[model samples]
Target chain A: MYVAVKGGEKAIDNAHKYLAEERRGATDVAELSLSQISEQLSHAVSRVMAEGSLYDKDLAALAIKQARGDLIEAIFLIRAYRTTLPRFGYSAPLDTSEMDLDRRISATFKDLPGGQVLGPTFDYTHRLLDFALAAEGLEPQKAEAAEAPLDEEVPRVLELLNAEGLIEQSAPADYDDTAPVGDLTREPLEFPADRDLRLQNLARGDEGFILALGYSTQRGYARNHAFVGEVRLGDVTVEVIPEELGFAIEIGDITITECETVNQFQGSKTAPAQFTRGYGLAFGHSERKVISMALVDRALRCHELGEDQVAPVQDDEFVLSHSDNIQATGFVEHIKLPHYVDFQSELELVRRLRRNAEDNIREAAE
Target chain B: MALDSSPGDPSRKNWMGILARASETDLENFWQLHGQEEDYDFLRRPEIGLVMVQGRAGGTGGRFNLGEMTVTRCSVRLSDGTVGHAYIAGRNQRHAELAAAFDALLQNPERQEEIEDTVITPLQKRHQQGRDDRSKKAAATKVDFYTMVRGED
Candidate 1:
């Protein structure tokens, strides 16, 4: 039993107008500019880009402004805008090795190549809030330049382990460049997904959800003795081979955070004992997200790695289905939208049952 | 546009990259000064689109879709039948058109040297300077470790 009731058009329009007024806040105060949001609230923009699966910082900032700083709402706006654009083609896979190093660190090694450059990090700072920031017009401090430049070639730490056959190779033995990768946007996700599909889903997954899952692993829920092999944040140039042009051309560069985790894996009957690997890469300086993504990535490999899948994080269907905040929010919020007919039927059934019970009690008493 | 299938010419590729990565304002200024006089027609109008960015599994593995990025592309043909194409990041149609126009002019052997001297060289220097400044700042943050000597050893 379904019915349509259309009304409140004027009320809806008024509500929207009120919302705009509320969003603007005080008239005396200056409105926040898009550049300010993009530069100052960059982490928020970065998160929106990662989850929204779009990499335009200006648009993300604009969405932030339009959504009144509700990041998920901003992400929704970006996703909607992104769906309308025509796709040119796929770009060549990004090479992290050539990233213009910003912040590169390795917890596993005390001293490695590149020597752990801590470029613009909050890691060493005190957690206490600085009252000085409240007072505007403070002069910005410039960092000192080094006498000598960093090495041209900073090698990856895992390559050292791979050289001695001490770690599992990240790529397949028979990797092909021409083979097609799985695309979730084009097709619905199926069970028993490959690493490629899983990575794609996790890359655009909700930060909070992924963080909780990663934290679960740390609390001994399908733990894999994880070690932070290396975490690098920097800019990498994006190149695409256009159909008109026969060769690749650089479009632009984007900042990304990459994490590679080495996990202890007791070799199975068919495999040799060696260190296994989990990887995470996301747009912008998302250290926590990438680190968490790596942890969950390793956990999801339980079946393939010959480990027991005993936790919710290890369940692919549960994790993948609930990871997307946009999908989760839409379904949860839809309950507020019109369930009147459904509830009315249940109400009538319950009342009828209660009446019958009361009549039966009276008859028994008589 | 005539297709030059001669492989291993790195100069054309380098210039194209420089033009793509250069700021729109800078490109516009340079175009107004030097490229405004060139007669050209649009082969394909500047169109904004998305390009799906891919990433390696472990930074060195098989490819996976990371996400899509906005790109604007255009193709133009010069009066002399030399064709130029541009694929730059972000949704700026004017920037793409200007880049395409410059690309077409650069393909002409007669105008190649002068354009390279005025437009390409200056843009390259500015880009390099920015990169150098960033690299130097990062270098300053590089950790320097020192070990204390113990008499017991």
Candidate 2:
């Protein structure tokens, strides 16, 4: 009888060697630079940074190159690295009011304080693909802007709703004073999660997973009519106030896409009639992700706003608990690991069933 | 609660906490049986169970256990004046302790660095030593059987 093979170490070592060789294909050619990846494959970099939960452009670019441009692998690398980094201190919650926005647009109002400046968007671009870029060694020319900068702070759309008392006031008193928000990474997701936990899930949740969950709401599952109250793409300041310093220090700026959704909600006996909120904020320019997140967030608020828990997709506990792609991926991939013992038991049961059937057939014949 | 107590007290204050722990021991036992304690701990708390789940070299099934394991876990202090926990796989006690220390660190925000250096590093080294001990025992058990074959017509 052929016994089980036992050269796994050698096989794994050889596989690594082969992988290294494949990763560095065409050894004569110069390897792609991190700066090139960051600049050229910016969208991929953004996605990696967003999902990886690390905002460093250079490191993300390096991850992309190291993972052979596999965005998910790049994200995995970033996450692994992120887990290792020592938690020195946490910066206080960002004040978006002081954000120096590079690009800000409000879909709710046409003429806001900050007039809409269409900054580097593909909304008006022609459908035809540009073939001229394929030609080698062509130096790109910078396009000149025709319009002057509309330097005005766009009033928050939510603020407008609040002014009319149309939206529920998100007062600080609503949150628990003693028990603050806990990091989702540190703790296992529990059922009947609060808004903070749900938001945390949306923030770190896989784009595709959030997108699909968000889509379910629009397909009449949650029946939440979501309007993009505001979608602001800008550079938000990250302030670090050291214990020794005792004052807020401007560490750096990070690109963020913040989307706030307004959904219709009727006042029940216990709650007042108001517009519920679904907020989405992601690292880098992930508009689709942010918008989708907002929708999902609003749908999840059905129970909190004293509305009927009408849909499976709207259940805060279910959605928040099962939203993590990392957990899902790990469990799914673990199935590839050893299961022979389980398989053996299954095989024995099947054999016994077959023998019993054969005996019945023989008895009938006799 | 006395720091320098009589040996016979058994520490009821600490004992109640242990009792509380034993009450919820079913989950821990369930994990000990089916779940890879180290892997689960690693995800939850990196500092405690930093020992890697070294897969078997080769076997009938994919990545058999081969009755060998190394694990790291951490006991932590919760913010609510309660002790916390995390257990992980692997020899990185620093990983476990950092996770544990981080749990403690998150609660107080005062003694982050002290815990990092004092608790995390030593635990990591101990975890590695445990792995080394297991490997050494396995190595000592190694034996080879040989036979001289006689010429047969």
Candidate 3:
């Protein structure tokens, strides 16, 4: 005896009503303006932009507000908007060496050139709750440090190793000038992606998933013995060469985070033993994501270096297929859809099998 | 494109930077002192809109949508028919109008020298000095390193 349910539309409407109420909990306080979300909760906006694969701050902030602070949903909102916009010309690759470093640090060398500029980091002090910050307008701010923007190009520490021919020099992985750029958004991703396409895919990959893969590697899954060579956060000027204009003009600047890992690569038949490099670049101060990306990137490079692919991270098909939040979310959410029709058929089949078994038992008894 | 290049200084980028750095007070004071007499008509009225600011991944790569920023832009023409344009950050409509007017006036040969000396030159100097001083102070904290050269058998 089975009863089929109805009113899916009504159920969906009521669910939305509940969501609205939950979103605006205690409306007497105030509705958050998009500007407040953009400026105050900037890291969230940055994350949405990075993960959404879009860079618009205002749109990201709006998405955050509309999505009730769900970072992934906000990312989805931005992505939807981004798809509608026409493609402008692409800019030249960012030169991190010439970055206007706001914060640059190294874990390898104690002292390196362009001394570690520890600018506005949460690294030092501390997880302890500041009770004063909970209340509004209590303490007056101290005057900002006399505005000395050093604007010095902090050179990478690995460059020193690179100078001595200690690190493997980067060559074009697949030698082809004017190689056609691969876009995951435009075309479905294929197996054994090139470095350019792989990086692009990973750059916009799900932060949590990428972090997990990276974590697995750190827990000795791939065990590359990687160290954070250099981590930098700064703005890089974007330039586009117009077909008519014939030269590049600085379109604007974008804030970015870049991570480089000095990885241990054992000498193989073709190559000698030296340090290998993994690069991670993201839209904003996304250290964790970028760091994770670097680790996963190195892990993915196992096959190319003639290393055994024993781990899940070493499987490009598994890693790339599952990394995208949009695809994962879509498939994951689809399960919540009404599946009565599908389940009813399965239920009927099981019932028929059970009835047949009972008849067989009765026959055996006779 | 009536001589996009400034005569004394050909770099419009430098002047644009100066204009961007100019405060409301500086813009207002300049008009009060010398720009009051300029007769200009609006070629393009001041209006605020979102401009898609783009960033390239790595410095050079495939384009990613960096984000959109609000920009207030306007254009004006002087009585002598010198056209001027202003593109500025934020939604400040009045500032855009004033900037547009000054842009037209600056193009006028009669007013170019006076505007260049009085408004442009001083602002450029101040901006340059501010940048130099900041860089110098930052340089003070720089750390120099020396590596040991090892000899192997």
Candidate 4:
């Protein structure tokens, strides 16, 4: 191997070829298909969509395959692709109330109006891995359908608390026309973002960062008891109401997992104690991410609700500002960029200082 | 009215005529922007600024210098009880007002709809227009021209 190299472009191409061969494995075996990844490795696809901030399963699966199963790399691929796509018009927010019932459940009340539809969840399955799956001999079994029809809206569990005046009053819904906070992608994120924008950032934030922040809450960095008020996973139609159309046209259906957490909070002496809310919603069926998001959300509500701010996790501004994986990782990794100019300045200063010290030593010896 | 993503203020109306008829969407979408977050409450309460600067000193212990910057900050208690703090790098009254108004609107249950329609949309429009203009200007300056003489070979 030569100590000096000049064929950077050629080296890069060769390295890429080697990587591709390694990723594809043996020529004797058939290459993996995108469909297989989407079906069998759905969780990776979901994570990519959640972090990459895109909702297409096929694209996510392709990214995963192309990235050699690196979810973060897959997310980077989707994000890069998303940046190049031309922006059409904005679609109106999806109406969850009109969302076709898929999987709806309320932990507050076991048998609510919308009967708990387990949907496709790993909750009931034993932790033990099935050895038959390794041999590809097992067939998935479908569960029997329950007789009861689930309701359209499983009336939010918080409503029950609101009736008794036990929980925080629902913030008035009169602000529908408010412009959404500017995207951090277009511009940098300024501090003190509102709860809505902050939540959006957290939803699209890196999984590991949010997971760590959420873990801090459990470790008593901020103690807000979080109860999974609702965790629903299913498809929701994306509708765009074109000016000429005069009505919403269904773009497509996207699978989403929404988790809303009800947190226990003690109010100031002037006000009665109530359960505050921390909501988490993410694209695709990502219950783990959703649950993690909800916990972090609750922890961030300390200052807003007049609760004593005792933990780092309780700082809304800090958590929301720092939890973004893209920004955090980008800033952290950007140190690899050319810093030779600054390093050169330091190097000159060091040589001068060392020479001065050596001169002082020589003078003392004389 | 200005679009949500545009730069400069329509209310200030300083350069409104030049931007009014622009395709607001195109203007807003064309450029990259960076946002800075400042701790307004911390700055205003104590009336002091602590600016941190780090540099390598003699390739030994890293050196840190605390320089004072003229920082202006404000806090707004929105009608809905949400308080927003905005601190800018310099003493710009307009930036403070804009930040405060945005803060108020973000939390106002009553005026949110009106504020979005009247304020945010127009600002965004202006911002976008400026971005598009700059990008086009940059594109125009980009030259990738080369030539070779046929007889020389």
The numbered model that scores best in DockQ is 1
lDDT of 1: 0.89
Candidate No. with top lDDT: 1
Candidate 1: count of backbone clashes, pairs at least 3 residues apart or interchain: 0
Task: Name the runs in model 3 displaced over 4 angstroms.
Answer: A1-18, A140-148, A173-177, A268-272, B1-153
TM-scores for all predictions: 0.96, 0.66, 0.78, 0.64
lDDT of 4 by residue, B1-153 (tens): 111212333332222222222232422332112112212222122121211111111101112110111233444443344443333333344454345435434334454466455555665676555444433332332223356667755
lDDT of model 4 at residue B15?
Answer: 21
lDDT of 1 by residue, A1-366 (tens): 346668989998999999999999999989999999999999999999999999999999999999999999999999999999999999999999999888888888879988888888999899999998898899977898887667788888888788888899988788887888999999999988878888989999999999999999999999888899998998899999988787888888999999999898667699678998889999988999999999998999899888889999998998888999899998888777777888899999999999999999999999
lDDT of 3 by residue, A1-366 (tens): 234557788878999999989888898978899999988898898798788877667777899998999998888887777665545445455566777666777889877777766655678787999888899978666423435556455667777777887876554334453555566666788888766667777888899999999999889998888899888887665544433234444434567888888898668689667887776778877899888988987888887766899999988889988888988998899777677788889999999999999999999999
| Clashes (N, CA, C under 3 Å) per candidate | 0, 25, 14, 20
Per-residue alpha-carbon lDDT of candidate 2 for residues B1-153, written as tens digits (9 for 90 to 100): 112122223222222122122212333342244322222122234331111111110000011110111233455444344333333322444544444434333233354345334543444455445434433332332222356788995
Between which residue pairs do clashes occur in model 1? none
Candidate DockQ values, in order, are: 0.77, 0.01, 0.17, 0.01
Which is the better candidate, 1 or 3, if ranked by TM-score? 1
Give, for candidate 3 chain B, the lowest lDDT window spanning 10 residues. B55-64
Question: Which 10 consecutive residues of model 2 chain A have the lowest summed lDDT?
Answer: A143-152
Question: Can you write out model 1's per-residue Cα lDDT over B50-153, one digit (the tens) per residue?
Answer: 99999998899989999988899999987878888899998889889988888888878878899999999999999988877888888999888888898985
lDDT of each: 0.89, 0.57, 0.71, 0.57
Name the runs in model 4 displaced over 4 angstroms.
Answer: A1-7, A147-149, A172-176, A179-181, A268-270, A334-352, B1-153
Could you tell me the lDDT of residue B46 within candidate 4?
15
Error of 4 at B97 (Å): 49
DockQ of model 4 vs. true complex = 0.01
State which candidate, 3 or 4, has the greater DockQ. 3
Model 1 DockQ reads: 0.77
